[model samples]
Target: MNTPLRRLATITLVMFVALMGSATWVQFFQAESLNTDGRNVRTLYREHGNARGPIVAGGEAIATSVPVDDPFGYQRTYSQGDLYSAVTGFYSIANSRSQLELAENDQLTGRSDQLFFTRIRDLLTGKRPEGAAVETTILPAAQQAARNGLGAQHGAVVALEPATGRILALVSTPGFDPNVLAVHSTSEAAAQYRALDQADGNPLRPNTHQERYAPGSTFKLVTAAAALESGDYQADTPVPSPDQLTLPQTSATIGNFGGGSCGGEQVSLADALRTSCNTAFASLGMTLGEDVLREQSERFGFLDPDLAVPMPVVESVFPSDLDQAVLAQSAIGQRDVQASPLQMAMVASAIANGGRLMTPYLVETVRAADLTIVSQTDPEPYSDAVSSATASALTQMMVGVVDSGTGKAARIAGVQVAGKTGTAQTVEGQPPHAWFTAFAPADAPRVAVAVIVENGGNLGNEATGGAVAAPIARAVIEAVLAS
Candidate 1:
């Protein structure tokens, strides 16, 4: 061949090799990601052809796949759609999956490595492929109580078994019905989703673990734990209780709720906490300094970016490198200190569980279609948030709050409830958010709960965590204990 002809032949061969390489990369190396992509229409159709597993709670299926007369062999359906929306989320043909539907998609679709043996058996026996059942830790009674307690309000409630870190109840309202989005019609599902997205409060957002809020006096639990752990304070230790505490180097000052005195010029730490004294905690926070407070906050699970109760939990935040003024505000869960209801519930759980903070988890077990267990979550410790002695002291102080202070609404008829109430300020002129966190039967605690009512619920500016949020917490505790 001539030199030009030889060069032309080499170029053609190079082009052919490039095409082959691209095909191999897409067909092999990138196959998994491409197949799992939410936008992949073919993958969605293929998945719908199989019988997806049921998402069970309290031994009943909350989410299940049923045979349909459409091209897609199965259709997803949710029981009590609005109540479980935050947990089950929706599996839609028009949009991506969410919550458990997204987090456990592999197991739910029978594609997880844990299900390999089951898949092989089904293939060999010529049986229809089926996904693994996902059993959640949700308690139906507690969940229903939380829903009824919240009652058409905008907020969230999280209840955890302190000893196990099993989420008993997780609720966010006003919630959207997953059924509306689960319809087989792509156009109908898309339209319904758009409406829910644009609705007030964005019903699609799960507030229990996905959203954050100022914790208000409820965060004083962290500050109090810091003080007790520092070896400088005790339940009976007298701390300054001035009506107004001026921040360092700034003219601005922090005052007690309703501008009232916290008993006297100096009050016991327990008394200050029982009264929810802002000035006292602000003074103590400045005294303890930012480092101690931040570390303590993190120990209680703030600033952890990767916490997942199966579904991803948006990390609670405690801002760093703050000056004295911001530190004072943050010390009170104001400023930039933000937390989810789940994080606050963990704080109460740690205190209830003798200061051992267990890692929170949602899914209890995953079982193959034939009823063989594929995976189970073991209870694990997340941190030692405080010493047992410190937790006891805090528990006693919290009980006092429920007995005589601002948290009286959380009182149970025959049970000793330990709790803290918070009224966190938000945008200027708007009502502050109401918050309450507590555990019941303090001596042998069964349930730890956190409740937040946004914009003071129906009371607006008139809402205090005690008046608005505490009762909700009380109802949840009652249900958990009764069950």
Candidate 2:
């Protein structure tokens, strides 16, 4: 070949190599991002073209895809839409997806690597591809009871199985029906989305795990656990419990609920916890200091952000770099201390499970179109939050709260219930938020639950955690036990 002919051949070969590299990058490396992009019309069509999987709980479908005569062949429909809105968020053509619909999209759309073999088999057999079903850990009875108990309240309830870390029920009130967003008409879905976005409480945001609130006295559980873990206190350990405590380095003072003594000047740690004594915990908080308290909080799954029960959970925050006065206030779950209901439920679950803090999970299993199990979530330990001895002591103390103290409303007939109550003070004008956390049949706890009623529910400033939140937690516990 002539020199010029050889040079032309080399240039052609280089161009051919570049073309192959670009094709590989687009088809392999950029594939996932491209397919997931909301602007990709072809990807949207492909996802909605097939039969998407159902989200099942208690043998009933909470979310399913039904055949529709449209460009997108299926329409996502939710059963008891509002009741389970926190769990099965809407899959919309115009607005895209949220919650479980987005978290488990890979499995539901048959795009998960776990379903790769299934997809190949279907393709080879000339079968129409279908998504994998997600079986949730939700208990229908508990879910219903939670929704009913939180009637007209702006709040959230979360229940967990102590042993398995399975989320039994997660309910967030002021919920929106997902069906409106799942409509075939894009314009209608967009209109519905706009209305829901503007609605009170922002129904689209799930309160159960997505938003955080002042934990109030419910956080006393963590403070108590820190105290016990330090080997410095026991249930009967006597601590200062004055009617009012002058905070160090600040003019503000912390006082008991009724501006009265916490069962006399000095009380047992158990008594202080039972009475939800603000002064006692504030004193203890100052004594333990910020580092110890923050460490204890982290042990129960606070601070660390990457938590997901399949769906992403906004991290519950325990503030850092606190002064003595702020630390005292934080010890009683105020002064920037915030937590989601799910986080508090984990706190109770850890105590009930003998201090083993399990990593909470929602999806129990995933099954292929042929009903073959593709994956099953195993219970995993997130941390050893406290020693078994400490847990035992805390359990007894919590039981006293329900038996004779502020958490009396959570009592169940013939059942030993362990619980704590909280009335977190908000801004000066707004009513305090009510909160309760409990695990029933304390000796052999099956359910650990947290309930929060924002702005005191219907009772206004007069509402207490025992009055508004404890009853809701009790209802959820009873439903779970009965089921």
Clashing pairs in 2: none
Q: Which pairs of residues clash in candidate 1, taking residues 3 or more apart in a chain or in different chains?
A: none
lDDT of 1 by residue, 126-188 (tens): 999999999999999999999999999999999999999999999999898898888889999
Q: What is the TM-score of each candidate against the true structure?
A: 0.99, 0.95
Q: After best superposition, candidate 2 residue 245: deviation in angstroms? A: 0.9
Error of 1 at 65 (Å): 0.6
Q: Candidate 2: lDDT of 69?
A: 84
Q: Choose the strongest candidate by TM-score.
A: 1
- Lowest summed lDDT across 10 adjacent residues in model 2 is found at 37-46
lDDT score, candidate 2: 0.94
* Global lDDT scores for all candidate models: 0.95, 0.94
